[model samples]
Target: MNNKSLKRWTFLDTINAALLIVVVLFMLDFQNNATVSWILLAVFAFWIVTVILRNIFITRVMKDPNHPMHPQPGEKNNAKD
Candidate 1:
């Protein structure tokens, strides 16, 4: 039930990281402009919260027995070929 693999970088992780950089850059660029600076900061905070919530969701799914990662009581994996 370990989710070590989920901790690895995914496409979402890459995009999030990229967006984070963009947001930070925008925030810096708008330092003198309070409106734009606040907007960029809010976007960055939203991104951070979303990443945290996504990880929480993935963890929940991984722990669910009915999830694809775990086979049902009488179901056999068809991977033997």
Candidate 2:
């Protein structure tokens, strides 16, 4: 990826982090002693954990190859045919 793409990805990462924090906080504030509240909280927890792990693993792969996030048009054309 070029500098521009890298910057865009960084922005996306920031948004994800913010949303995760909001979800966690929502889980805490939810005032219901029902099964549904518990289930929702668990789902949010799973999503947050998965996002963290995926970012860690994918980041390594992304750096190994140039244009990890995006390829030039000609480069992708070669793979198609």
Candidate 3:
């Protein structure tokens, strides 16, 4: 795709990845208490949903063969910008 759309999607992927990492870290931390675990679990579930949606969006975008533009061979595949 074009650089504009590519950059927007890349930013979204980075955001989603960050959220996923944060949730995982919170879940794994030994200092987390019971209530904290529950709250983090709730937010983790929501973030998981968003992560799945983000994955679907990226998958759909990749499957779209009629992409108006594509990156050059030596450029980054996921982050064109």
Candidate 4:
């Protein structure tokens, strides 16, 4: 993958790490369990959205010329076409 795409993937990884930390800290803090549950739910939802969007973006990037993930012409992907 190009440097730009690699950077984006790294950024997404950072976000995922931050979310995991937040959830871990929240679980460790025992007070306000209800609020913590809601916050964790939101965090999980945001993570899911980011992953889905990232996949869509990567798929688009793979279609661009010169992208490392782009399939070569006349080469078949694993998926049946």
Candidate 5:
């Protein structure tokens, strides 16, 4: 993939990691609280949705000829032509 695509992926990964950390911390801190458990569940659900959406986006972009990450004729794989 191109640098731009790599950077985008890195950013998305960082956000996901941050969310996971938050969820873990919250679980540790409020393991006995019912309301906090529900809130954490919502956050976890949102994280899962984001991961699924990111995968879908990557698949679509890789398949699109016009996308910068897609390889073109006479160009190296993952190189923009």
Candidate 6:
């Protein structure tokens, strides 16, 4: 991957990690509460779905020829142009 893509992934991963920590803290603070457990479960599910969507977006940006990540002239054509 190029430097730009690497940076993007790193930034996203940091954000995701921070969010996970917040969720874990909430879980700890509200231990044994049935309502809190259900809320946490829904939040966790939403987080998973968002991560999957982010991966799909990153893959498309890297692979789509029309994207700025596309190779320059005379360079290797990894994309299915």
Candidate 6 Cα misplacement greater than 4 A, ranges: 1-32, 69-81
Per-candidate clashes, comma-separated: 0, 1, 0, 0, 0, 0
lDDT by residue for model 4 over 40-73, one digit each (tens)? 7787778778866867766676668676666566
- Model 3 accuracy (lDDT, Cα): 0.61
Clashes of 6: 0
Look at candidate 1 and give me any clashing residue pairs.
none
Shift of residue 74 alpha carbon in model 5, Å: 8.3
Each prediction's whole-model lDDT (CA): 0.63, 0.54, 0.61, 0.62, 0.63, 0.63
lDDT tens digits by residue: candidate 3, 1-81: 346334434556677678768767756553747777777677768866866686666566656656544445565666324
Question: If candidate 1 were superposed on the true structure by all CA atoms, what would the RMSD be?
Answer: 7.5
> Which tens-of-lDDT digit does each residue in 5-81 have in candidate 6?
22234556678778778877765445568787678767777877876676677677766768776555666643331
Better of 2 and 5 by TM-score: 5
> What root-mean-square deviation over C-alphas does model 3 reach?
6.0
Worst lDDT 10-window in candidate 6: 1-10
Q: What is the TM-score of each candidate against the true structure?
A: 0.55, 0.40, 0.43, 0.46, 0.52, 0.49
Clashing pairs in model 4, backbone N/Cα/C closer than 3 A: none
Give the winner by lDDT: 2 or 5: 5
Task: Between candidates 2 and 4, name the one with more favorable lDDT.
Answer: 4
How far does residue 56 in candidate 5 sit from its true spot (Å)? Answer: 0.2
| Segments of candidate 1 deviating more than 4 angstroms | 1-9, 22-31, 67-81
Superposed model 4: Cα runs more than 4 Å off: 1-3, 6-8, 11-32, 64-81
